[model samples]
Target: AGGRVLLVEDEMSILKFTARMFQKHGFQVHTTAMNGLEGLEMMNRNIYVAVFTDINMPVMDGFECVRRFRDWENESEERRSLRGGRQFVCAVTANAGPQGDRDRALRTGLMDAFVAKPAKIMDLVAMARRSAEDTLGHSNGN
Candidate 1:
């Protein structure tokens, strides 16, 4: 079986492409959301090895969604224990206006990784693989 993943994007094309790329790289099951609000709902009911969310979207932007999701995730010991490792979520942005914007987002620590617009699928897949390994290493308190 392949890892489970979630793709939160408003653009249909990007969503489809990202999902296909993830599947090609061994993420067999992936859920999609058109907005951040929907993304949060999906996160509440499922377990995903990774989540790729666009920074800008209607109905609750990526930042807020991730913030709330993290809050919910850290709410209880049981919830945290249910995971094999740390929560992994990536922020995808098309903000090429300034490098400071990207740097600020990273400094916020809301996501495990960040992917700029026109990102390379191979790079994304590689990062996910590394993150999964690192996260899983913390499983069973080992």
Candidate 2:
């Protein structure tokens, strides 16, 4: 089943198209800017089952956003379900499979998956489904 999605994107066109796709697939969608800081703030305010964020932006990059989100897990007692254990964050970048970028995302423990830009609709749907399943498992105390 499709789940709630938090989309952090800088590119307007991509964001619009992706949002549309999420809607078509029966997922609830929330959106934020390219800035990691703002995205973090949004996550704190809402409960998303999964997040899809871009890698680069003007104010704060995706890497920094992910880092902050991961860091939040340590310092806070009240973790928002939007940004909690079952919520997955995925990198949707135009890095063209750059190993360093992928490695950085992995090392930070922020992203659960990475997909190159212009991602296939099916891929996005599949990831969202997987995230939903994972979240259900966590919710069930698994």
Candidate 3:
């Protein structure tokens, strides 16, 4: 089995499809949340190797969720220990407008990477692999 992963997406179809993809790729555990607030709660309770979040949604947005996660990670040693280290966060959004939203999201210093909507399966698989490797490396003090 591969690493555990979390997918925070408002769109139900996308969420289902993506989760299936991750499971097909050998991930042992894949969880989904409809919005950022729910995602944050899940994150606090479970240790995921990577988190894939949408940029825009009702209630809490991805930016706020990432920000809150970073805060929790920095402030709580227990939370950090639960994760074994920092977990990779990837922004998955359909918003590729002229404003460079992806760049802005990355600049927030919360996201480790970005993937536009209609993402390639190979890219998603690679992202999970990379995140798992990163988590392993960090845990090993590399």
**lDDT by residue for model 3 (1-142), tens:** 6688899989998888888888998985455589999999888778887889998988999999989988998888876764465768889888866676598886778888888887886797798898788777767777
For every model shown, what is its TM-score relative to the native structure? 0.88, 0.86, 0.90
Q: Write the per-residue lDDT of candidate 1 for residues 26-105, one digit (tens) a residue.
A: 88545569899999999888877778888889998988998998889888566687665357888888884566436756
Candidate of highest TM-score: 3
lDDT, model 2, position 83: 32
lDDT of each candidate versus the true structure? 0.79, 0.77, 0.83
Candidate 3's displacement at residue 41, Å, is 0.4
Pairs in clash, predicted candidate 1 = none
Candidates ranked by TM-score: 3, 1, 2
- lDDT per residue for candidate 2 within 1-142, as digits (tens), equals 4778888998888888888899899998876565677787877666676788888886888888878866775565666332334357888888846576677777777788988877887898888888787777766767
Ranking by lDDT: 3, 1, 2
What stretches of model 2 exceed 4 Å from their correct place? Answer: 80-86
Candidate 3 has its poorest 10 consecutive residues by lDDT at: 78-87
For residue 18, what is the lDDT in candidate 1? 84
Q: Give the distance in Å from residue 46's predicted Cα in candidate 1 to where it truly belongs.
A: 1.5
